[model samples]
Target: MLIFPAVKASSRLPATSNNLHPEKHKDLYAVTEQVIARAIPLWNLSLTPVRLPLVSNRIKFKCPEYDMYLEDMSDSEGPRREDAKMSTNEKSAEKNGSATCRTSSNRNLGILSLVSVPPHLEDQYPIEGPRELKPDNTVDIWREYEEDGLQIIAKLANIHLTPEKPEYEGGTWHVEGQLHICASAIYNYDSDNLTTSRVAFRQQSNVQRAELKMSYPQGDHDFLEEVFGCEQGGSGVQDLVTVDNPEGRLLTWPNILQHQVQPFNLVDSSKSGHRKIPALFLVV
Candidate 1:
């Protein structure tokens, strides 16, 4: 439902300078524009956007910074009066209970010995039965998000590997974390003189599924590597699959999985190598 610019790279272009080479900058921008035009379609193919109702995108909700809402409640005086009445009732009950406990003999010592539980803090908002959420009957988060739309955060990175530093150490395992990132599209548009690099996806899996299919000694739950293909301690992370990040390859996956780039070296160690990538992360 949101109509905006296709991409903001054009808006984010650096300003021209008098000392800058104008012709070279012109060609650079021309190429970048063309690449972006081509990449938009691939981004469309990357993931299907789901309309999720997130707390950040909630409409027209606010909190008064200086107890202004409390001031408004004071003007109404209804809830305050009720609270005053309830406190008086609690004091009266406590006094009566103390009087009865003092008058009791050794035969009623059992009742006196019983601990008195404090009144629940939620007595102010008491309700019949459970006034909590029922799992079977759920409330829809997206009640009326008609004007909402998916948000995208874009990233562009250029990496050059020279002969002295031919091997890329790769990236650590992580998830994209801007505004509830749900999907990602990584397009490595250009690679030269580099070996094939890959991105591996991994996540915590349900070990109980495999546990139910087999019989084992009670409390002997050391099947982390045997069943889930991962070890215990720091060496183990459950892997699902890996996708190649070669030149002009567009790889996409949901952000539910943690991802990391695998190590790669130069195809020709004598020469330099590089890769240019533009990634788009989708948020809901």
Candidate 2:
């Protein structure tokens, strides 16, 4: 594990100030430089800190930039050009004059094809999976998170936090649409093997609440990584990134990217060791 030193946000010089001279803020500059030097290891990462009411209790690991350890909050900027690798079925179709490549559609995903888009329905679960998909009905609890959560994400990401669908179509935008809340009970060790990896809308599920979610400490199995070779830094995995799911941190990303949680060994072996996370899917 790579250990990165913590940097305080206050150490940095404020973006807006009347004083133009560096000498005026020399002390602030010195502290800012020191903090940045310590945080050098995280230079390649995009870090955003958010506090949800339920996760920000007196106890538990609480760090402002905890989201840095996780990845995939931003969308791919442009379409990637890849050499076409025809699958057996695709090759057969090509020979029979039934195949026509649509590079435009696949370029954004850096893959051959995408899964069927899930239908949009209010307060209803995604038809493709057996999981809870509820509305943002609990306004009191969610209201606290609105400004700090999606609003901050929107500002940082330069996305509109609109509830309606975005106008851009055909993979132009990765994160889009109004925010949706999904709550579900995580699987125990027995049912862990049965869980399927999926996105929020089969298209955009950014910012999933990952509190008390534990992964197997020691395991030789990662089906998505081993079988599909979908691990970060692997082939055909350029567009997607990996984030370590530390407790109380939120994982944000575009919905089009394929993601999966590796099955992990339970830290504690008891009925009390189950994990549940309420995911907040939105356009920011």
Candidate 3:
């Protein structure tokens, strides 16, 4: 009988090469490098330390006082607190008949109290009273936000940004680059954590789009925790860094850094809350 001996399944298995699972053997490092190439220029720019403060590149923090001041005076609204103190001062001034000017005693005025401090103390008041609160004149407030953004960017990029006068020629200073501004309003809704690790732009026919991502400074993580009230540590998902959304704060970062904003929910359903952000990108 020339019957062949029965062979075990293990012995019948064919020899396989190192790439047994070709699908799982993808070059992830190569893919990451290719993705990062999109942001190489900007990354280099952030590092290249151009000592001009001609533009702002920083993240602004929550200015509750500023917000309160703006909201109060918005639409020419009157202060809820009766300016009894101001009235008293005015009555005293009139009784004294000396154009009396006393410092503002209203604690609710926030940073607006600075207006009381005279520039020359020669009775030549620039901000005479609360009525002089013009939004345009509040450039100093905007400067605070600008400085905040610059500070964060300086720390991240390991560069010093000093205020420098722009080069002037002919009749105007020569400024290089286009200012790209984008504003987004976030209400009581959640958004997916979108990474701004790479620069992307697209245009087709009539449609045009550009996107930039900003992240808060690492030192502000605790502040984010307090604001977000996230009891849990780390992102629930692994292999990701947790950061709070810039949320009305002016934030700037190299396009190479990965960042994301956690979903936020309002504590009070009866009241409305919103986070509005306006970002500026300088493209040369």
The global Cα lDDT (0 to 1) of model 1 is 0.52
Q: Superposing all C-alpha atoms, what RMSD in Å does each candidate have to the true structure?
A: 20.5, 24.4, 25.6
lDDT top scorer: 1
Evaluation by TM-score, superior candidate among 1 and 3: 1
Instruction: Provide the overall lDDT of each model, using Cα atoms, as 2-decimal numbers.
Output: 0.52, 0.29, 0.27
User: Could you give me the TM-score of model 1 versus the true structure?
Assistant: 0.48
lDDT of 1 at 37: 43
Candidate 3, residues 1-284: lDDT per residue as tens digits?
01112121111111221323324624532332222222223333443322211122121223111222234454445454433344565567548853333333343343312233223542543344422333343222123322232111001111111123111111121211224211111111121222211212111111011001212223323333332233235432222233344322233343223333433433343344333332223222
Candidate 1 scores a C-alpha RMSD against the true structure in Å of 20.5
Error of 3 at 234 (Å): 21
Shift in Å, residue 173, candidate 3: 42
Best by TM-score: 1
Q: RMSD in angstroms, candidate 3?
A: 25.6
Number of backbone-clashing residue pairs for each candidate, in the order shown: 0, 4, 6
| Clashes by residue pair, model 2 | 163-178, 204-255, 216-264, 216-265
In candidate 2, what residue range of length 10 has the lowest lDDT sum? Answer: 61-70
Model 2 lDDT per residue over 1-284, tens place: 11122233322333433332467756644543343333322321211112222221212221111111113323454433344455575467458855233222232232222222222431343334333322332222223332342211111111111123222121232333335422111111122212222222222212112212222112322322432334433444323344444443345443334445543333333322223333323322
